[model samples]
Target: MMVNCCGLLTSQKEPVPLKSVEVELEVRDHVATVVSTLSYENKEDKPLEAVFVFPLPGDAAVCHFSAQIGQMQIVAEVKEKQEAREEYDDALSSGQQAFLLEESEQSPDIFSLSVGSLPPGESASIRLEYVTELAVQADDGLRFCLPAVLNPRYQPQGSGGGEGGNVQVTSVQVTSVPASLVPYSLSFSARVSSPRPVSKVESNCPLDPLQYLNTEQTQTTVKLAAGHKFDRDVELLIYYKDAHQPTAVVEAGRASSEPGTLMGDPVMMLSLYPEFPQAVMSSVASCGEFVFLLDRSGSMQGARMKSAMDTLLLLLKSLPMGCYFNIHSFGSSYEHIFPESVEYNQKTMEEALKNVAEMKANLGGTEILKPLKHIYSQPCIPSQPRQLFVFTDGEVGNTKDVINLVKQNSGSHRCFSFGIGEGASSALINGLAKEGGGHAQFITGTDRMQPKVMQSLRFALQPAVQDISVKWDLPKGVSVIDLSPPITALFQGQRSLVYAQLTGQGSEASEGCVTVRYSLAGHPSQNQLHFSLKPAEDTGLTVHRLAARTLIRSLEMEKREWRGQEDGGDKKKKVVELSVQSGVSSAFTAFIAVNKGNSEVIQGPLVRRNVPTPMVMACGMRRQCVPMSYDASPVMNMMALRQAEPCSLKKRSLPKQPPRDPLLQLVSLQKASGCWVLDPDLAAALGKTSEEVEKPKPASVNQEVWATILALIWLHGFKMDAQEEWELLAMKAVSWLQAQKASCVTECVDAGNALLGCTVQKDVLGL
Candidate 1:
């Protein structure tokens, strides 16, 4: 059989060699700790070695790796990358089983695992553990994604070696396949506990009904539905009832470790959702130089380009009247709408909108670095802070270089980035915003681009939070030993996590408190959280490992800053020492395990095989579309529009039967209370089932608010052209919207407009 492994087609002499995979995830507060166990068997009648290249969340910090063969278990230890590789090679040559795990130097999201010299018919169980901070979505849900697909990244010509000259391990092109066709099974389960009540949980894949463990709903457990194939990426969205509340947790360190060390002390994780005064929010600057950078790369050729254009339209229209703006589109190269940023007048805005409408993903490869350099070279407008809005599918391989550039220029501008589509590189999207001191958002299937873009626009316009500090109040004997880096910036409603080591012994009854202080619009504000000194339940080494990851990240940032300078060596050494001490894998270190218990030395040349992984076709596409060359003529603009027309016309046209008229259907589905409830009938008209819509909403979501919003969206979308036909219904919606101040009607309308591609005036709705 010929198998598609990565981008290479190879003939396989046996059935799919890789077997089942099991994943155990534990989420505490805003961080998630994941343990993956892969079971593989050597079915061939010879010694075999396997190489598997897989994808992980870009920010994951791998902390543990071990292999179990028969009854012997060998735990891996963190070692310098080169040394680990050499040791593994020696073990393999000496007829010993060895396992090595190393992260790709070029892309943080990719990792290569090698399991060597497994005897015939013997099975090996490989277990790996990692820790990462879950990203908060625009709707305030915490998102945890396990990447099961590794789409081949397009590397442009003349790009040279990326960051380091790390050889490309594998190129896996996404291919469409039915779930049943996949050869492997996946079993996943997660335990979620938060300071705030766990309202609900959602997943892209089928999941068993959630089981709450406590009446307060502070803890819950969920697992994958039975007989689930390893098909698409596994995504879980968790919502907390009081997500914005400030909370503190102190985790006890490892008891067996010596005192005065990271493992010996208690660690406190502080989560702060800073609420800036409304006056400060309203005082955001109305004058700034806004530069919009759109990705025209080939990977963004379909719905992504359309979404970008739509987002650009919304952003261009929302800019302050007196702000200056410019638009740039880049692929292999870049083109600008204007020679430089011009005043946001009617003429400029109209011209930019026209150009954006005609924009297409004709640019060959994603070459963002050159254009970034060009943008940075331009002089900044006096007193008008530069804000860059980057829209991309985040397919670039030179992620580290791009982020470093953004970091170097952080002082001059703030960056807001959007990652388009499912396979978008989280590293690029999150790194750009993190290094540039701004915000990041990801848009996937059916996600309205406008609301997220507009939210980012509001963030860009907000005044910078300055003079941030954290103060600790504890008993005299208790002190903070190692503290994470100081807070660089803060935005309203965004949660900031701070990790610190609480050293020394204090009475369990003592009160420990922390206060976060920052300046907003020249006004000083502080948020204080108090907790007992008593250590929380034993979470093993989760807190310590998380703290180590934080410190390692800070050290890596410092290394980037000292890239070509003399201090680089010292920073590298420190990172290595910290990684080794904590058993966490870093850029300079890897995890290696070797088994020496085998009494009989069976020496033979092991057949090396690369294990294949299932590919996920791009969202909304049925087949993989090959990107045209850089010099190819532009086709995506016309093609996309043509393909979109059928759907548009279908949506606009009423059904042949009056009973099926979408507007009438929606009205018929509404309750006597004048709100369209999320019922099965209404969901069917919207091309979804009620269960799908209702399952994701937590107790925090007011059904009335959501139902009203849906009804308004339906009216604004399908009935806009025939308002006379539904004016009575529209009036009722308007009245209902007015009566309910519980929801932000204006924001809802904006979100609806963005999703439906309509420009409904908020003033018309009396918002």
Candidate 2:
């Protein structure tokens, strides 16, 4: 998780720069040219000083452009325009162009400047105009940054005119560029510099993969013979030392063909791992008090909203018997569905879920931090495990303020945050969680939220091991260290994970026991658990921060590479440390490297299992994401496919590329037909029937026609009765097609017509 370590500042104040990135690229006649434009909008309550900096490529053969900022006089730069050799179309029109002005059929370039930084409620627009020669190529070669500065600040513009100083820009846009010239990289960052520093800063961690694994049922294993691939799920044990109880994590699973044997189709597979110490289950417990902050924002209108609701329903249904909970939802406005924290009675819970279902999302502004402050100020119910769970897609009105608020209010209450979807603010969620002494979790897509919600709810209900804290035992010369927050509240017997970083040249590893102090609900004194960290042979400062730093740097560099090609060369840049960092850690770093490209194509054990298949296609939009098992469960496969490609069903067949597996289709059809059933006629035709010579029955009327051709061939023994067979096949085919509403889906009608036309017209009608 990337974080701006500074304390929260008021939105009314100016923002200071915390970091700067610049990108450089070679320019040539053959290289992609920079086609740029700028548009400005003032939507805020202040006049924002906008400065757009588009740096030139290092090896530019030529560069030319006209620039302007509204009606104000501004300095503009002009470079030599590259020579063009294409035949000029003088007769096309008076505006006959020399360069090829090919327009893309889709995804044309556009620059929009909406009103921004108007007085409290007003709005205004800033104009922009620019043009450059077309350097046709597959790749882009220019760079730019929105607010290109190191220490940026802004002030609210009053009715009086103020001194017009150097304007600093924070964002950029492209114009007159081909769709194919789109770059494959992009980076985004916002930092708070020179701010009021109250306390802590945080780093956001990627969501735990185990949270996506479905675990509602007992672990089931299926054995596969050689040459078989089976999709499935398995339970993983989440254990920590000195915790009350161990937690179980489920994983969606799959096993491909193992080594030898004739590979016809994938069948089944399973595994048995070495078991750890026997886990002791703890008594059922419930939190003292809880608040569920849900987002009912506009962007979460369809599938995402459905998934969120469904997951909420599941949690409501499974809440502990005596737990107390509150329901809070926000979008343009905030609503406490339950006026106050209420007991977990069946009626109240049902009413809450119903309210969520009936909710009409009033999508507009996102006022995140304000509502939390209100909730925090309310009097708490004493003696209960007091906590708040902020559930959102992580968009915020002001991130820094929200983080600071959570941190300040977290002394007596724990705040756990769950990011619902891709647009969620990682930094905000992480900060809220860290400040509230809770773990922050991110759900990438709607379908992934259910399992995570279930696991989190279960954990929240478990007895806490007590408040956990961490302090660095700094070695000599180690200064200016940056440390991640301490993870608190382990299960009664579980261990906590706490890490810290120290800056400096030299520091020897020291032997010391890190003490974890916590207390059970109703317990007397705090219990102190100690874990010894004997400086392993590997105690290098760089070694410890390798994983964390690499992930950050790789993402940073990727953004620069992206800007180089997108906004037309050298407008933005980053150091190569990013790529090096991506090569380090085995886990987190791997995510950074792969996240830069298409996730599906960069396959891995986890990636393969998560890739959308036919199963996902059939699930439709989830009301709430539920933990999913990828095993050979026909229902699950259908559900996966439904959610992933709801529209893919319109297509008759899956992609024909042989490299693309046909198994997904087969599995889809199998599930659609209600699982495997004996094909009696095929068995009879093979003379391998087991006293059951059943006639061919189509899975549906559509498939029944497909069976008719085979039945006719069998009846006439493939000879003299060919015409009769043709007539029968045609009759059945047309009838089945009609019943199946063939015309509704073109594929069914087309297939039916082709088959009947082939047999009836050629043999029976002789036309």
Candidate 3:
């Protein structure tokens, strides 16, 4: 047995020493290319092998890996995973230096790297390179995260056992220590280039001041601050000016390949920002079945759970009177607010609000699969489209399985997903929305939940775009081969990227045009884009690689959909061939390196060591606790009850304050027109900022009606317990609302209820 510096394992032998690490990242537009170099030295007298388990972004596609032994550099080659493993084992047994890397079948975020048979006192340097798309935050800032912490995922009872039931329930060991105690040193730097001006760069970790490389402010460089330990995940948020503009880039293909092939042809990437007509925006359906699947796992404790509750309150209040709704909270198991979805009347809305307030993260572990299966098993109401809103910390291990299930049920409903907190799994959050044809939003740091949640609700309420088609008009000799799959969904003010291979190049002076045609709210609409045919300068194959990646993903998705059939084998083989040809690593192919110099067959028993990762300190848990484990027994009920005690204590320890009169507050906060402006002062009183309050507004809301509705909601929602004290002020607000004809009172009330989680009566307001 082998151990790591964190002391996560009990081993009889000494642990190997890991030296320093260097990281380099290049971010262009919304994609990131990362390279990491790890150095290791073996101080033992005998030859030794080192195995290191590490974390990576779940969606990253590893492109290159190589190892340096002494003065020899051996580059890796992509091959079938099992074949690569066999070759690596044979090389190690023959006393040749070899390196092997494989992603965990249990978790895509975890990877194991083996440096085998290093002679005593010899040092080996390993380099890895990967590319991943950066997710856009709700604020339109691009988010890039380097994961340094790996929290152990607990498998639920009766679930498929870990590693086929032979391995320990918790296969990976996680240890937590103070930042200063970490032995590893990290050096990271990034060069960012985008079409839009770089507004600013922010990070959770300390960073040096950003340096602009050009006068245009479109290119910049940033590095970590001095004395940064490899502790928490390194997160960078990059903001760009004019972020929503549509653009296109034409890239010259590889000069070394045949002209007819995909790599040898020119490629074009088009970014389309569709702007729906105002008439279409105002035509959203008022009735639908809204199902909420909330994660109540231990990881979602504290601020995450609070945010979910706030979001749920807004959703409950926003539902139309005739819409059907239900709420399901899940961890190890799930509990529903009602046996079936009920119409969103005053009674049901109030009941949901009360139950939502009591929802907690007392659930044991994140076991979302069963709850999702259950939700899909229920029948959807006719004429009312089903919209599923999932709020989670996104710590599930079976991400692919979950996404597959959602895809299988995509026809029945659309899924809008919210990823809460830092280091949430992008694979799960983004995959769910992508497969289910909906939008994805992430909430982190001090970001408010109202705007993002309400934006998704609006999307859900909008009628789906239909009859999508693309038509291209190019100069003579110019042909297009579509690289991306057909567009499945579109939303107003949202950007969609289409990539195509432009073969049989046209004249440099010629121009090409493309039009996207679709129907929104039963009205036919089309967007036309025109661009020069000239190839852009110095693109450096970024567009080509991205196009390849997109095609690979589409093919892989098809394979997953057709899995277990005869065609699955053909699809799998095609994916491997394409991956190898493009030098892109896939789920079926691995990069392997071997150093065959001085191949003397003298070797002892090779030691297999598992490196320990830093445990993520989450959910108010202390650092001294062991890594979380789940047993295949029915003890979760007791565990959940025990967990609730600490939560109750935490709640009780907060200092108590006398409740303020909400009606008096509302009256004091009202403007001169008997309306609330949702300005900074009023926003502060409502525990929000002016920016948050003003961000997400439906097209149908009128300022006057909205302000009056908010004022009335403030009085009704908070002062109901002391109605006698504020009855006069509430009546005045209701009268003001009744007098307003400038806006549709019904729409304003619905918007206010959705935002404030209040069920103010329209009839009482005489609207």
lDDT of 3 by residue, 440-531 (tens): 88776576666688778878878888889999999999999999878777887767789999988678889999999998877899998998
Q: What is the C-alpha RMSD of each candidate to the true structure, in Å?
A: 10.6, 26.2, 8.2
Candidate 3, which ten residues in sequence have the lowest lDDT sum? 163-172
Task: Provide the lDDT at 32 for model 1.
Answer: 95
lDDT accuracy of residue 508 in candidate 3: 84
Error of 1 at 523 (Å): 1.9
**lDDT string, candidate 2, 71-181, tens digits:** 432221211111111121221122221111111101011111221111222222221222111111001111111211110011112212110111111122111111122
* Model 2 residue 318 distance off true place after TM-score fit, in angstroms: 1.6
Off by over 4 Å in 2: 1-182, 185-281, 467-488, 491-510, 522-767
TM-score of each: 0.79, 0.38, 0.81
Best TM-score among the predictions, by candidate number: 3
Clashing pairs in 1: none
Top of the candidates by lDDT: 1
For model 3, the stretches where C-alpha displacement exceeds 4 angstroms are 1-16, 104-109, 154-182, 282-285, 445-447, 598-602, 628-767
Evaluated against the true structure, the overall lDDT of model 2 is 0.34
Work out candidate 1's RMSD over C-alphas.
Answer: 10.6
